[model samples]
Target chain A: MRSSAADRTRPTPLDGLVVLAVLAAAAAIFYFFRPVSGNFLTARIVLDNELVAELPLSDLTEPVTLEVPGVRYPITVEGENGRVRVLHSDCPSQDCVHTGWVSRSGGQIVCLPNRLVITVTGGAAEADAVTG
Target chain B: MTHSVRRLTRCAVLTALALAISVCEGLVPLSVLIPLPGLRLGLANLVTVYALCRLSGRDALGILVSRCLLGAVVGGNLTALAFSLSGGLLALGTMWLLLRVPGLSLFGVCIAGAAAHNTGQILAAMGVLASPAIAIYLAPLLAASVLTGAVTGAASILLVRRVPFDEGKP
Candidate 1:
């Protein structure tokens, strides 16, 4: 009797365990690869390397509307000082806000959907990349 | 001699196809609306997912491993290898598990695999950033995974049915 594809059993517990282990291991490896820190306040709205807006830390108190001629991008800067980033955007990808708060110095916020970027400049906040 | 030669030829062909897709897709610039780094379209995954069920496990692994190594070399960036490795392994493992379920077609299996792969990659990125806050991106990524997975899974199902499946014979 030929076995049909429908007779197959679902993945065993070992399979899930293996996948979890792989993810955890990869996380451990990348944790070591990230940079500690270098610069500060590199925060600027740059598109194609052209500075569109110089977003000062003080301006982050409320949502700012950035007009890109044909399109208007609403960038909301949330969170308090020390940790700051574009918390919201009108773009489709929402990648800008997803970048999270970039205050780690040398960290950057890039919104590919809108061709926008917010780069922060600061030095290392911690010694170890894992802890920081 | 013919059998061994055929196996090698098959692997080389699949590897090249996977690499080509990876590079070609990389050229298409599709950035996120947010500034979160390490996000991508994951187009190469379509090939990897297709190979897992259509071909043997070792063959699929061979294609993925070669694609990653050669892709990094070609792109001149070693950093991407980690993401691909983690995502690929997890995706393959998930597909393997789900593929066993009765009536779970390749489309369903691939969709599950895609979701798991994205989760794995995001987890890695979060670790690198050392910020649990990045977990918020999971929602968007999961959404994208469903869409991409469904498309890729459907394509693979077509390919499987059209292409000859003599090796596994299932």
Candidate 2:
């Protein structure tokens, strides 16, 4: 009798355990790396590894649009109360535009083609709670 | 000498198959729905899993490398080669190590491989973009890996069961 590949055992208990462990670890990482919710959030716009603008969202009396310097494609960005997002971009991918809004600390919207990165960093409020 | 030649031929075919699957997967507008950077079903890994189970780890690694290189060209840029290589190597390494464990199934190995692959891509992205803050994106990515890995694992298991590589014959 010739043997076929079906002889392998069904999913063992160990496989289920491994899957659970992977999921748990992922959840824990998501929790650990989660953006902190603070009273004040600052949106930092970086272009090609340089800081182009930093908007203090808390103190922002009105929403502002940013002008990125020396970018190959035109990208429109808007920042308002504790959040920021790309409104539009001439870049073909539209990856940054699709990122929508980022309001929490450590959140980011990246445009790889244009090398534009918008990140939200919260200050003071959640630091002690998050770290300690 | 003939045996080595036969093995090389098999691995080359395997690499081509993997490349084809990856190319087909890319054709789907999955990115439009998910809108997540670098997320995919990772169907190409099925070939790697099948090769690893039936063939040697060396063969699997060879296929993975060649497929990534070719896939990058098919992708229309060299920058993608970095992501594919980083992810493919790490995913293959994780699956290879896991195969040594007792009583583990394709499910565990493939799922773990997927997670490692995503992590490797993010690490490469951080390096290329010089942005550490993007690390937060790993969370959803890791979660997505489990689902994608499960799909890949289940499909490979079927391939392993049904497809006869005809290893031994009278």
The C-alpha interface RMSD of every prediction is 8.6, 4.9
On a 0 to 100 scale, what is the lDDT of residue B68 in model 2? 89
Please give the range of 10 consecutive residues that has the lowest summed lDDT in model 1 chain B: B29-38
Candidate 2 per-residue lDDT over residues A1-132, each given as its tens digit? 121222354676777887787778778877777767677787778888888777777666688787676888998888877788999899999989877888888789999889989888886643221110
Candidate 1 per-residue lDDT, tens place, B25-109, comes to 6776445443434445566666665566566677778888898899889988776777777787888787766666655555556
Residue A115 Cα positional deviation in candidate 1, in Å, after optimal superposition = 40
Cα lDDT of model 1 by residue, A24-132, tens digit: 5445544544434443233555776676555444324554444433234665654333455677678887777767766655567777766766666545332221110
* Stretches of candidate 1 exceeding 4 Å from the true structure: A1-132, B30-41, B165-170
DockQ of each: 0.05, 0.26
True contacts kept of each: 0.02, 0.43
